[model samples]
Target: MAQSSSGTDGERRLDLIAMGRAGVDLYGEQVGGRLEDMGSFAKYIGGSPTNTAVGASRLGLDVGLLTRVGGDHFGRFIREELEREGVDTAGVRTDPDRLTALAILGIRDPDSFPLVFYRENCADMALCVDDIDPALIARTGALLVSGTHLSRPGVFQASMKAAELMKRQGGRVVFDIDYRPVLWGLAAKENGEDRFVASAAVTESLQRILPLCDLVVGTEEEIHILGGLSDTVSALRAIRERTAALLVCKRGANGCVAIPGAVPDDLDDAVVERGFPVEVFNVLGAGDAFMAGFLRGWLRDEPLEQCCAFANACGAIVVSRHGCAPAMASWEELQLFLDRQDWPHRLRESVELEHVHWATNRHRDYPELTVLAVDHRSQFDDLLAELGAGTPEQVAHFKRLALDAVHQVAAGDPRFGVLLDGRFGARALEAAADLPYWIGRPIEVPGSRPIRFEGAPDVETSLREWPLNHVVKCLVFYHPDDDQEMKARQDRQLLRLFDACRATRHEFLLEIIASKHGPVDSTTVARVIDHIYSLGIYPDWWKLEPADDAPTWDAVQAAILRYDPLCRGIVLLGLSAPREELLAAISAAAPFGLVRGFAVGRTIFHEVAAGWLTGVIDDAGAVAALAENLRVLSDAWRTARDARQAA
Candidate 1:
């Protein structure tokens, strides 16, 4: 098993340890526009070495990053982001004298992305040999060094020291010739450079460290500068003569070629080509992603061809997206992509590949959530009809009343989320989108005969029209003993919805209620849950009914963990029970760590909404009653949770 550097046993077994640049990248949100006219920017953790480390970590590798960042927010942001992605930050140092590096990037065209580097005496470039620990390098299986750092004296010395330690310890030294000419004072501006004026000084500096690397990777143009030859074949030979290291050439879209050191005089026979065709979006971080993928396979002692293929796939995926580090796919997503028959084919432009990438890599940090479910349609109609007021105006008024109640309960709390539907709560749902709270909107009609989806004719079209930030809350009444045809139909419907949610990057909340056809006990619920997982549909949240006992909750929790550990904890659903009964159920479920919180709608606001619709109570009265119910339940859940934690 691969051990992380920060393991408690002090066992220093890391898959890969990288040393070099780390910075923040500010990306322009406006596509097809120049950087000057862009209005908004999205911040991402940038820098080649940092991106590679993050990519490898996401691919299930235990990696560590060694660099320095300023004692500022950007530095802290970089550290937090890396840690969140499972990269070891034990070697990351803080320097108070300088600011962290910054890169301003703009998507000017499909092939051109304008970038400005602000690294004048930046903290990352100020790395020193003393900052690198030789013991740390010895513990890692491989040490990856970025080439741009070698252009500067301070970082160059540090890279050399790290390489020396890795070589001395019998570990592999992988050198990524990440050539950024502008960073080395060779180019006037920061942009893509295919070739630069190769000076003796540049060649001598690169040659000094080339022989020390066990493996060297660079583009055709990068190899030109390293070998002082413009012709790629001649350059490959020149670099081969200088060092016994294996050479890997990066050919964008065309794939890559690997030449081993033990090859005979014939270079063509020894060269192995591997790659997949993909529509290029931005080629900025493709190389870094390739390096990460290659290293993942390389460290595991996989075949050279397999490593090259993996590298090509990683590169292809990143180039089709917008950002670099954040766009890298997880191991599962990569496998899914590769398993398809369309190895080199591109999806349509309407399909945002970034959505799938983001959805797969999304990190779950919410250990506990308090959700207020107000997605009641049929129940609301019944209440309004009982009051002799079943008009559209009355329904809209009732929805507003519910929204006001939710707002009152969620005013001072940041952990509150609301589940609203489109039937009568469309306006409320729109208003909830503007609030600083987690919002969940329903996709299935409240109580269709066989549970029909709302909105467009198909689930995909409906999801495409949904706001990206809102979670797709799907309620299904499924029983373990339903007829084969009915079960199969619902199964196919859910599978389609899951695929749509994943493709469109919508967080899903699957609310499952056992149908009245069968006895709905904890065992039946667990059986239904198991059946859902067996179908391979994983949702972000599971809104389930409260279990009767600790063992029952444990069974459900075990099923969820067994199927998908990434599944967020379960939230209790109200079955239109009384407020006191719902509170009791929440208290019983709150002790289980897997039960995060509750999503009780009718119990909290059904009576209040009815009174407001009948004009028996004023708007303020309804709001007060609804708010009190929500607060009481929220307080009860929290108290039980805190007590369980304390005990």
Candidate 2:
């Protein structure tokens, strides 16, 4: 068994380096629609090597990708997506000369999918020898190169160079026979769905690098093309004649067979690790998923049987979901699936499976937050009415100043964030767009009893227009003891908002103010969250009125951790509490790790905002006042946090 080395600090070396294409996959949303007739598509970062790299990272590998994308918006998107998935992008370069690649695919039926590639000299194919870093290659435990990169001259040289570097460093070289017929010019330009074509030139090109690989993987058709033979066993033998690399043949639903030695006369002479029986939704990226799962075990020096099991389960899961990279399972999700005694044929329909996927796939971490809660629409309107001299425009400007105060307190720090609403704070939201603030935009109409969205009749449709960085914040005023009808209506709205957030890939912060509906104790607050969780609503963050006792915070924390351990920690809401009370609340909750930080609006900015609106203070005076207040609260939080850590 081969294993990767570790540094003196005990962190393992890079587990795998994948070199090849990176592109955007536009998967047609209409299940049975043709590519020409499909009106909507879901965009996901894709390409064989790219998907494999993301999948490996999800499966807990220190993976990197060596590819090139055009200096365009899609290029930046590719790099960002890879980084979000925890893949090292040091080797992913930008090709100024070429555009990024794209594939437009539609599921005509489970078996008959249509695809058209837009790769007329794509940037990924422009990956040259200049892009291959020997030092980067030497740090990897394995180099995995796809057949698509070897189809072109420049990319072929680059891939070969990377493979040689890995081999020189005593790292394994894994080859994925990612054979695409149209890519090799063996099919019509529109025929990107065509998987294989027999070409002597292709066989010779692949054989040139076969001996360089320690492990080789391919489907039956891909093996036929690689070996220039029609029969699977015969092709395996022919490949074995050319190289001593271990051969793994993917047999789709029938699972896979691994041949560590000679090619068997009959495939049955080898052990076939069976795959999970899943109803296929789209099979376009299953092979890449299989490769990812196999490498997850292989890099850990797990046995071939275990590797095949991981590979088969991964392929099965991806086939039951839409898109490629997004459908790839996390290691925890995989464990849940394997550990379960019964699974639905359509894995996509499993709520538990989808929840696990949603929870674990999120790469962003908000360990602590000190956010300025300026998302008060109704409160701002009341304030304007009280002042009688301020316009909506003035309130909007006030929100912008609040954002500035936030900047003054903690500029360039992600832990500090803002909860700004679109009604009066739209300008503030726009200004904070380019900043590193963890912006949370409100959708719930300020203080709606049953939860009505402000401007969005259709929440999911409206979320499509929002920037991906903006977390959706919705506040529901409800008691667990509310009337059955009201509870049902509120539950429906929250569920709809949650589903929309999931669809749009936005983090959700569910703010509960049960005191608005009825007398609220700490236990009542905990019941509200537990009740929501029981309804299968797992929000990324919870915004609750500050509780000054440990028991209440403990109960709330236990409920959250029990329901969704991946739930992003809670943030304390101000609710116009005085400075001393808010500080006490922060101090009380700080000892428990679940209480992340405070989003106190009134305590930090109410006096300043009122003074500014009533002409009692200048903009600089207002900014200074709010900034100082925020600094004090932040200092208190740090002191409590540091005390907790020391204890």
Candidate 3:
């Protein structure tokens, strides 16, 4: 690549700011079986910003690379690679002793080519805007940013500086909200909710920069978190409310839709038409490719829909090949992918069974199981007595409802054992027992209190008699009065109960009430968890709060943070508990990625018939619902955990 003459700050051309990359990616041919099947693997530029820069260059954009690579071989490779791809290296810098980002491409499964990232102390993590010439950004056309650049001590400031410079000069600032949950370091290993709250400062960091962007790109998933919105329309509403940028959300296969205009349209009737679906390739650099295509179209003043189509075409090509950019197609090559559907069809159809099995595997390693219903106000006598006074036939029906829940889970997943909010009563349990298949050996046995963690008198006897996993029921309290007496009870008597069961094999739980939890008052909760674990015990999960009322966001978070056995989200206790409070708690915890696994007995069973209404309150039906809900919670827990780690 030829070096451009040092020009005046006002006359620079295409001085792009690819502001967010902390590592380097090396692509080489795949020799392994898994690699071979995922298509030929070739070493290519890896960072999203760098990849976008390369793609733009290939598309005839005069682009500059502005990322910090380490003084090591990896960093050197990144610089060399970018230069070869026709990118301007005027902004590249080196850091001695600091390593460049490195990733190993291993095709573990042909279905998805996993790129194992190695990014502990890379030099790029040290980039400062001072490293880039201010004159360059003053004359640039667009500045690009990816989410990865916002991490610890230094790089974040550096990336932000360049973007601000570009914006100040009336240039366009582009954002790719490719939020990586893992690196955000929310609830991963740091200290639960408190640490999560602290780490969530990323939101503030993003707000500082997003306002400067001319356009922000994100997927349906990323939009949900950054914009705190669910569907496409809501995401646009939220983003537009937050920043003055044109927000474009990438919808895979279903096509892409850009929120029309800079302001969100209340014309809830605002028009949004879908773009065409192109084939999905490796998906590694698709977003970058999309940016490349979109930018090319934008520079030409193309229509919004056409811009999306170009981006889609670019993404389709990159995904089909290996790496982020070596295989990026030209304008004409992009058309070929958009016109075809066979690759997309084969990719989707070939993985149904494989995905199911993989899903089962993940459940074992990462479980997010939650049980709803059991709560503090609940007593065995109360639940048993109300068995929805019914005739013999109706009673039998209730039994079947409960039984179906237990049996369904036992049939599908080996790791699928979680407590049930059993307020629906014995009929539901009976139905679960009636189920025929035993997917795996039962984890708990019937009619037994869980074995305590420590030296409960005669603890050995309890362990011998009760099989822990089969209990499949978690106990919780929706609310606990904030009175000193209640706090004392939890700290003393309840704490002792936990103490008693520490080392026993009959492991189960009596979760503390959450909804009613108030002011810190003391450090008892955080302390007790350590005590319980010290006795070689693990809580299956915690219901988090009371069943009757919604838990305060802080209260739910504080409780969840105290323990570390991958507890599910707060379980709802009140049958009539309004979901609004839960929604608030959910929103509070979501940004930090602190929740997912949840349960509630009252919320589920209270709405239907008290006794067995064959249609409304059948026991068999409850069992089925239980199984489905368990799987849902388990999946949620797993996702948060995986994303946190990857981020």
Candidate 4:
């Protein structure tokens, strides 16, 4: 079997191979405004072939792009962007002689976006047949070539060669009548305005390639250009006469139509016009996104109706957001959008939709977190006694005030996270769900009662009931010298918890504490971690006390990586240590990449809690005090982390 060098197991087996234009799009960021007055712009990977490749990849497809990029910063940017999205760039050639193409797009309104293409002697247009790798084409399930690239002789030959190779190797050909007339040198103005003009030469070139394609996709305007007919029905008939490929007509807002083989005698019988009505922002990349969705369903052998639905959803999502490639939705995001069922209207304001968008767009890897651990049960009792207020209502009020302090500290900072519990922090946890900060819910009860989880009877049920955004933090107190039977029981319990976490898809943070029964040393911690891994228990994050030294932290990190390289890294536990000491420990750990951040508890707000209970400070004073301490710790951690990264 033919294979691409970049493919896994040395087999080509690509879901889609795209050969055409690849460029950077500089989109104006000013919404509800004109292009001239736009103050800012965002850069995104653009072009029909590139957008399709990225969109399909986002939907979990193995895709590759075959194009040329100038050996410049923009070219590097394009390559990196594609690589980040899991698009195979092995076929992306770099030309030292030319510059990468760029598109300056301005959003004047939803219906009108001004665009100027800077592709005169651009690297992508210089694509040659020599750059075509026949083996790679053969490995792909489908080879996609855009109409713009087909307009030029050099790129046209490359696209033709790729299609021919793919057909000979039993791969399907997908032709996107992308129809960019500005590239044909027919639409030029002194002010760099974009215009489209239908010409016989353009139609002839497209028709020559149409018969070789197994599928042809285009918008109504694109079809008019290809078929040389103004009427939609006439255009479909003309296109059917030239190619036996499946035809897909993309009608913005009104949905799309997909016809198998030639145009049916009754065109209405073949058309599928289901689509989500979305508030259009910029319609530039919606077609490419639509193609991506259709291809995802088509390649998966889904029903034509379902494929059109996916296409429409994808197009709706892109049109509602900014940029092209970056605005494409992942499968999870798309599913959430579909589940809301509030389409053809303003659904962007829905919190559920926003949550899905944020979660899906967040980085897959663990982010740098400054977690504040305030899951104190006994500490609250001590404060209540000091204040002489034991009523349930008063206790709840105090807890609410403390949680408000934490919220105040975390407000405006996305890096901040908090660890709360169901006992005293239940209300806080509920509130945290609506906030942007990460929330860690503790599973283990406080104190050293042989490391029992709080609410043991409902541990599994509670974990299952927890929100998907929350992390489950399990603190286990174990000693190497403990009674063997007791140790075995604890191990069993931990294994059960780990399995439960895995089953529920909750990220686990294992907080290991070496009891007085064993030497509280780094070696002991490392042994415990190794033993846990041996039992097939790997956690996403490690919550540990400050290591005795830098070497101790290094040893712990080494063991963690050895067991699970993908571990989310360690966070230093406060253990009620003095503020100065905790800060020092954090500074030491901050130098290591394996140390993510700290989760300090009492050190931050213990004094404030005491003061508030004794009437030495008001509620506002307490909140202010906690915020100050949090800010100090957050700044210290950032400084240390930034310095280490710089070094």
Candidate 5:
């Protein structure tokens, strides 16, 4: 529903909606170069709205949190945490039949933290308008909500109703567009062998939520994904007129600018406010904090730029600590940090920026472009599990999503290539039909002999009958473990396999210990080195792996480089080796650009592999903990891969 032009307006008393599920942040995954054998995590209440409430309250504002929590202890704990931070939690609803949301927070290193949420069919999704306290919203200043809650019908309906109410009351509605693809329904192919995602459902759901918000805040990349706008100004302008609200576009470190309206012409016509700078520690809550601060500024009648600064400062402070809500700060604390900065100021004649010229300038002309979304073999399983599709349909649907993802990424660049790997779900044949490049194995079909992927020479060949390329990411764990007997067999095959693949000169990903056939002798190392040097095309990248016998990073490097010098990356395998240690090896090997990465399935899947992957009755109804472990492995790979490219 559109906000009524006819209404009573006053100082904003924000009715912030924590529409998304709330949960506790748990720590897992590889950290500090060692695998953590422990499970206990420092508990903290975290969620987008929860953090926003704390950040806003810290900034001193009137904010109320609305959402559902279970009647369980975790739910009660969540409410208490909100109240402790001064957030008005009386509006929160309780569901007797459900459980509170919990987030599995993990660190692959300092930066690559991925979250696996347990909120499917949970209490948070049960939030409906019946749970809403209309009086609370009626007296509020603004409505702040996140897009995550849009995944479900009841919560979605409730959020929509609240937005309508806020609009009718002339209160501003702010949306922090955080779309977690994992949360938006995907499912696996039931045969326990394959998985895929439905593209139409994902797209249709995204389109449903874009029009309701007034001031939208999200990263440039997120905007590109949601709106398909590659150009900065044009994308903001494109989404402008679609909704009557101001379009606030974030350019990351460059700060954010708000368009008066969402229209192409608004780029040149709107009031643009530049942000004050702050040394950012954590960007997690900055956008939401910014929204809270913007409302805070609006309530206090402060200038727009000051609001952006407050938001950025709030974000900067949060990032400097751990979790979402670090601690709320007073105005003096924020201003003290701001005043310490020595920035150039303008009086009468500083720069030519502030002066407005009536001259109509030509906007940068961008070529007509196609956007393709690449589906890495990594996402195959998760997409499958989430979309809930059967084998045949999963293959077909996954094929399209994969093709679309690739096309989106390669749109502007001519050299862009889609790579399909058989190392993923049991069905790569569907994907292989389209992609031209591959790492290993021909895409295989189910319940029969595998078929060759139709593209160029790739992993869709022999020996790919395994998940080596998928489970063993080149950055984290390059390959799985094999006995000395298997090692001897591999070394003998390495030369012949190298020659056969060398015709295409395909570079196979190898773990030195796993590939070494005969012995740890230098002659054996030299022989293998000679073969690797022969067909030298880097297949994206080749990673070094620590030997099962020798877990140290130096030993792994010395073992590989004693034979070949180009070992830039390493995979930390071996069941006993700690993830933290492996990370340290990555750090130590930085001199060789060796700080690159590893593929660690066992390190991640050890829970399942060790028979420790089981959960109580709660996890019993869903997929096995091992399935989750595998998903975690896949998620970790995506995080690691993204981190590498981002660097």
Candidate 6:
């Protein structure tokens, strides 16, 4: 809200640099359960500065995180998560001596959240003077330092060095009073839930850096600890005396008060912005989210009132949801939330808002795909039966060979993928996870007309164990003209599966085989897709049979876009067609751009698997043959794509 002429340099790369902790958060999934009784936990990126970095990035700010994490998988996870959120990670250093910080949190009630910090000698705390990059501090337009980093002497010096460098460059310095007494050793190490435990040392340390800050944000308790006074107004006055920095006092449900000038004698006279009144589910990372939202506007020189409104709305949205960083809304979603005056008071229950969140926050892009579909269950069993000597182990090994073929032709390629099932290809699935290929797993029963999930009685429970990167794929044979009862049952099953994927944050791929129920015309597939979308089920991907003509592809694209313009596009399916015919279909679909690529299964794998099972080929021979077949198809798709682009 204040101008700094030195910060207006055109060469600065980032708008804000968040300097502090970077770590992982494991939140208990079971609500109303004690931390000791928790059975499962959901992993998310955490730490106050990390959350603020992600939040600011989501709201369209060019932000960078300046912190350290351990040289471990969890540390790599933090850096990758920040990068995915569009935050620059050039300043994210890896500390080899200590592990990354971890926080285990659980929600027992609306008012009670149990937290335990495992940050002793953590990597972030090991941030020393050498980690501070003077060039980075000079180039940033603003610097935000969380108070937790200032608790220990070593990191406190690191924080102060960055702040002083930013001050010397005339860049803005923001202070988020992220005080936790347990982290400061003022409370029992086990009591991380305690937000406030005053210490004269903590107060004195904060007063030392107050003069350098351009803006200071804290809850009432944090302000009290900073100003060394018990009264809110007196604390505000005392803090005002130390620095002319604008103070944003966060008042948890009521709203926040921004005192840009001197403290008013009466608390009611402060400039206040009202917060959205919503049902609070968990308030763990709401303050971090608030700071993120505030900076989204603050760094852009927006009005302080507008900045506070954005901050309050963001905090409100996260408190009504689940984990911290993942719960932050995208800029588009936040605007929609504010524009809709009659929105459902419960933000989580609004389908429109949830869809916006899902669509906007998805950072990965798949412009094209070439996937091998080896997830056919009953067909593999039938092949084994015809061989009369093969075991399930052989099928599993053959599946692995298929994966090897995929790797040979398209290793490290994001466009190449595999669609395999856990029934017979469990070993193959395990091996595929390490590669950079697009991995999809099927859950549909081989050929249940009304749709049934394999392996588990409750599909939702089974999905909890799936890796977040694996897309959930389901196949159904349905005709628009089917009997009403049968169609309704299939619709209900599809809805349930889609809901499960949404709940678990997995992408959903719906494969429709309309020809199985009746003869398919050019328009038949498009009609079935329209009917499904009419039922309010918008899947992330649509896998369908390729159309013979341009008009048919046009009809399908129109139907998909009419419902969800952001759909992940379609993938052409191969139903055991001849190689020549499949190539022709690829050439036809290539020009449309709506068809992403192809998932041709039996066409490429059937002969190789059959030869391997019947003793006509060894494992190496089968792998080579499968690789050759897939290579031909992949080359054909590329040629078609090139030809279309040239035309």
True-vs-predicted CA distance for residue 482, candidate 3, Å: 97
Query: Which candidate has the top score in TM-score?
Result: 2
lDDT value for model 1: 0.81
Count backbone clashes in candidate 4.
Answer: 2
**Poorly placed runs, candidate 6 (over 4 Å):** 1-12, 266-271, 387-389, 642-647
Sorted by lDDT (best first), the order is 2, 6, 1, 4, 3, 5
Candidate 4, 372-452: lDDT as tens digits: 778777777777777785554554555567667667877756677888877777787887767777788888777644667
Per-residue lDDT of candidate 2, residues 119-179 (tens digit): 9989999899999988788677899999988888998999999899888889999999999
lDDT of 5 by residue, 1-647 (tens): 00112125653344454455576656442343322443545466767777677667656676678888899989887887776566777678888999888776544443444456677668877888787677778877677777677667777788888888877877777777665556665532121111123344543554565566666777665554455456666656555536666566665555666655445554434444555443343344456556666656655667766766666655554444345654334444565545655433321121111011000010111111111112234343444455453344444344444344333433434222223343342354354334432223322221111122223355334433343222212211102233546434544444444433422223344434323323343233324334444433222234344432323444445545554443333433333346555444434433333324343433433332223212222223222443343334333434545554577
Please give, for residues 1-647, the per-residue lDDT of candidate 6 as tens digits: 11112345554378899989888999999999789999988999999999988888889888888988999999998987887788888799998989999999999998899999999899999888899998887768899999999988999999999999999999999999899999888999779999898789999988888999999999999999999998999998999998999999999888898989989997668778998978889999999889988988888889989999999999998888889999998898889888877766677888778887888788567888999999988998898888786888899999999999899989688789999898888899999988988888998888889888876787888888888988999999989889999999999988888888988989999999988788877788889999998877888899998667988898898898888887888998999999999999999999987788999899999988888998999999998998899889999988988888899
Total clashing pairs for each candidate: 0, 0, 62, 2, 64, 0
TM-score of each: 0.68, 0.96, 0.47, 0.60, 0.46, 0.94
Q: Which of the predicted structures, 2 or 4, would earn the higher lDDT when compared with the native?
A: 2
lDDT of 3: 0.53
Put down candidate 3 lDDT per residue, 1-647, tens digits, no spaces. Answer: 12243455434366455765735555535533543354533344577788888777766667887777777766776887676666777677778867877665643433454455566666666776577678667656788877667666577777688788877878888888766554566534222111112223665566567788888888777766666555556756767877877777776665566765653444223324354443454567777888888887776678876787788767765665556766555544455445655545433232322222112111112233344332212333344456644444443454345345544554544333323323333344333343332111112222222312322354343334433223323333323334555444434434344333332323344455332345432343334445444443345444344322224444445654554424433332333455455433333343334443455444444434353343554555556665565444445445545665577
- Looking at model 1, report the run of 10 residues with the lowest lDDT sum: 347-356
lDDT of each: 0.81, 0.89, 0.53, 0.80, 0.49, 0.89
How far residue 39's Cα lies from its native spot in candidate 2, in Å, is 2.0
Q: What is the alpha-carbon RMSD of candidate 6 to the true structure? A: 3.3
Point out where model 4 deviates above 4 Å. 1-12, 189-195, 363-647
Measured by TM-score, how close is model 3 to the native structure?
0.47
Question: Runs in model 3 with CA error above 4 Å?
Answer: 1-12, 26-42, 106-113, 186-200, 229-232, 262-279, 335-647
**Model 1 alpha-carbon drift over 4 Å, by segment:** 1-12, 190-195, 262-268, 347-356, 365-539, 542-569, 574-580, 583-647
The TM-score, computed over Cα atoms with residue i paired to residue i, of candidate 6 is: 0.94
